[model samples]
Target: MSHQLSDISHQTSDTRYQPSGVRNDAAPIGVFDSGYGGLTVLKELVKVLPQYDYLYLGDNGRAPYGNRSFETVYEYTLQCVQWFFEQGCSLVILACNTASAKALRSIQQNDLPRIAPDKRVLGVIRPTTEVIGEYSENGEIGILATKGTVNSGSYPIEIHKFFPEARVYQEACPMWVPIVENNEIDTPGADFFIKKNLHALFHKGPKVDAVLLACTHYPLLKDKIQEHLPIDVKLVSQGELVANSLADYLRRHPEMEQRCSKNGRQQFFTTDATEDFDNHGTLFFGAPVSSTHIVL
Candidate 1:
């Protein structure tokens, strides 16, 4: 089941699939997202740890996992994790908040031991939650995310584990994702939705001094979000927090660090059209990207 760099060349009539020119025997860290949102996290990872090779897979064809059932998110995420293992990845990061909220624990606790004991999978939620309390002076935190992530209650649960004194408030921005994905962040429609959600979140927790953009895609709307936020409130995004936590994790576990390949190589794959992914992905990734199409 091992895949080589050359395998990326195999393509259908409608799409072009290109793999990295580097060799694949070395283990690269895998980054999985339900769609292009994960690119923001990957962008930070490369900035902080550019030497490590990375494989990013976006399940674009079956994306918008935000509202899916927990069982369905887990199933889709596990399948993508297996694909990363087949491609010789020793570690995978669930960069999507929805996937992380719904699937990460199940995969780490229930599936990894049975399928690949030596391999590891991490998520964005824990890292963000670990230090979220420090950003709030009032001990009141707000979470803005998709319906699935807010419904999962993962942030409140995990944040309590580390910062028991913190009170967490959540608001599901159902229209935010669609606004970002449609490249409408600069429009009046985007402003309306962003303001609506922010108002609702603050209404639930008026004393909230810090707000976490619990969804990866929300970072793209940071500017607009900040414009509507109270002047003193802090806006916390997961990209830098997750990146720093990952660096610390690798430092603490040299065995896992040694398992990661460091050749500065990166590859992108999508379950939908490469052209569309590349155009939208570049916006999120902060760099021009060319992606290959994958079926699963």
Candidate 2:
């Protein structure tokens, strides 16, 4: 079911996804997100697999996929995945919960087989849930995510698959993404939404010993979230969890691992202004970043 190299329409010769270059196994791993948040995941990935090369794509111009409809998210995500395929990525990780919740399945089940079966696309939910139940001593965990993810019911479904006894309570923080993307996480303006969202989560269920930051963007509000929660509640961030899970996945699938190039190089791409991506990406990624401009 592997898509032939001829399948992708890499329109421009100057585009990074241009099909002219040799398509080989020693290609870069692709990391995608609706915006800069996924840079956090890429940061951890580089830490764990510094030897491998990575090409990250941030769809910032049309971001906040959390508010988009399922079909739109799926379509947009599929476009990015195809772009990665054109760039010769052997694997892709959707670092967006909204995209993962609404789009990953359709891409994996429907599109992959027809378009690029040989390439693998993984999501954050399963990896996060695989260990989430362990933190729920009371069998009840809280989920803080975007509206799309919360509406998708992905957390409860994935969590129950691993811990049937565990209860999942979700709160959709619609305003949080805007606040973080605006680089206002530390501002007083963010407190209202942060407190409001946490309050809603606590009211949704009994005392939740752990709260999963279901959206990658939420980690920027870690302190605010923690301050709003009980002292003992453990905050689970997906970057580290997903990174570890991916490391294990590569170990288990040697064929895929062997295909990844270990050049210790990293590349960043964005649909928005490259300067803006570098500025905000540096904030989320925890370092300086130089991103290239790309069209979908």
Candidate 3:
């Protein structure tokens, strides 16, 4: 299911943009995902912070990090983080839910201090959880994610930490990512799997007031998901929510904000062949992007 690009070097970028108002903060913010899904997160980020530079790295070659062991995901994520740091990123966000659930803490705790002491690595789960409490009026939320994320129990744990009255229920949609990645988003094939997962989640819990699209890839299935969900249940996606959370994080930590370069430029990198990444990436990002081939 994979192929190689002979001219991967053509995908890399040049860093000679004119300084906006530089004092020494010209590094781009790093966004890493297991694959193209994180572009949804980055798209929202561009809307909120169109002034800052961003570099996105998708490990498409070893994607669906959801099915891999925690140790494997941790090692892969660590390699990507180090690559971003080497590319001059002061702050890196692990935009994949599985990576965040299984690898983020270990990276922050063990890798950051030893590798890039001044850099920071954040995750989508924390940002998504920070505001979900406000969306749960019935004190019940359902999470639709990959098996790895569900097994990690990050959503339930973090949600309780923020809203104890709110209950969390989750259903692992292992097939959803493959469906979306294969460009079957709006097909009947996708609809069948989407409805089946939503039904499982609802049947497993009390009438949930809101359903959290726990994986970034799940957002592509949002419309189909809503079509099958009860009228009373609201579907929450992580893109805008995560964007707002990141904006707030930067505001609260001016030190980090000041360190981010604000030139409104974006660069993309992938562990897969450039041609394949570009073809699929445009579908996720809503625009055609020429990506550099990179290895971690």
* lDDT: the better of candidates 1 and 3: 1
Could you arrange the candidates by lDDT from highest to lowest?
A: 1, 2, 3
RMSD of model 2 against the true structure: 7.8
User: By TM-score, how accurate is candidate 3?
Assistant: 0.91
Q: How many residue pairs clash in all the candidates, one count each?
A: 0, 0, 1
Model 2 over residues 68-142: C-alpha lDDT tens digits?
999999999999999999998989999999899999999999999999879999998899999999887898899
Candidate 3: 10-residue stretch with minimal lDDT = 1-10
lDDT, model 1, position 130: 96
Per-residue CA lDDT of model 3 for 1-296, tens digit only, reads: 11112222222222222222233745889999999999989888977766677899999989879989999999999999889888888999888999999999999999888988888999999888978988878888999999999999999999989888888999999999999888898788998898888889988896898999999888888888989988888889999998988888876776777677765677889998989988988778776678999766
Residue 215 lDDT (model 2): 87
RMSD values, in order shown: 7.2, 7.8, 5.7
Question: In model 2, which range of ten residues has the least summed lDDT?
Answer: 1-10
Task: Give every collision pair in model 3.
Answer: 11-292
Residue pairs in candidate 1 whose N, alpha carbon or C atoms collide under 3 angstroms:
none
141: Cα error in model 1, Å: 0.3
